[model samples]
Target: MIDLNNEKLELNYPCKWIYKIIGKNNQDIKKAVKEILDQREYVLKLSKSSKKGKFKSFTLELLVHNEDDRKMLYDILYNHDNINMVL
Candidate 1:
């Protein structure tokens, strides 16, 4: 059996996770990443270093509320016109 009080306790704080965002261009990458961070109610920990190549990438660690919140974040990123890919 589960305790109602315990279940309520779990909902008190936001959950955190790391997301790696890969895109086609540097400007678009930064713009997309910033949009996600700014538009959502999340705390972001952006990667300081990224490998340089044909594609631009940034690793972002986010402290979100739950799985749904994460999915929303992904949806926003994926929908951005400047963003070609996200991982």
Candidate 2:
């Protein structure tokens, strides 16, 4: 078995990356993403919501030029006020 913690996963540069964002409001999440990614092309799709509808989730896909770009996007989303969780 491979030890994921000790191994690095190879990723091609300028590839598509997907982020799963969960938040209290879908519109708020979209707005936050738009504000951060302004002018960049991306795809956003509604993934799901809580049973009582208190929370929502979305799948955001975009092109990442390299590791820094991909990780930077994750940091931005993870630090956004409107976003509760990121994966």
Candidate 3:
């Protein structure tokens, strides 16, 4: 089996990146993304929700200019109050 802990992802710059964001409310997630990615073109889709209806998830796809830009977006989403997880 591959060592998941030591695995590293190599991504090319200026490529399409997808962020899976989970939260308690879908609207809150959308608002947060909108505020962070203001004026930037992106695609957002409702992924799924917890069976108990307590959490929701969304998939955001966009073109990242570079590694820093991809990481920056991850940080922004992770810092959002409504967001519970990012993957």
Query: Best lDDT goes to which candidate?
Result: 2
**Sliding window of 10 residues with minimal summed lDDT for model 3:** 1-10
Off by over 4 Å in 1: 1-13, 39-52
In order of appearance, the predictions have TM-scores of: 0.62, 0.92, 0.88
Q: lDDT of each structure?
A: 0.66, 0.94, 0.92
> Candidate 1 lDDT, tens digit per residue, 1-87?
766764543443376666766666777677667765776544333444445565655666667787677778788887888766667
Go through the candidates in order and give the clash count of each.
0, 0, 0
- Model 3: residues with Cα > 4 Å off, grouped in runs: 1-8
Candidate 3 per-residue lDDT, tens place, 1-87, comes to 767888788777899999999999888989998999998999999999999999999999999999999988999889989889999
Cand. 1 Cα-lDDT: 0.66
Clashing pairs in 1: none
Task: Output the better candidate (2/3) by TM-score.
Answer: 2
Q: List clashing residue pairs in candidate 3.
A: none
Tens-place lDDT digits, model 2, residues 1-87: 766897778998999999999999988999999999998999999999999999999999999999999999899999999999999
Instruction: List RMSD in Å for every model shown.
Output: 6.8, 1.2, 1.9
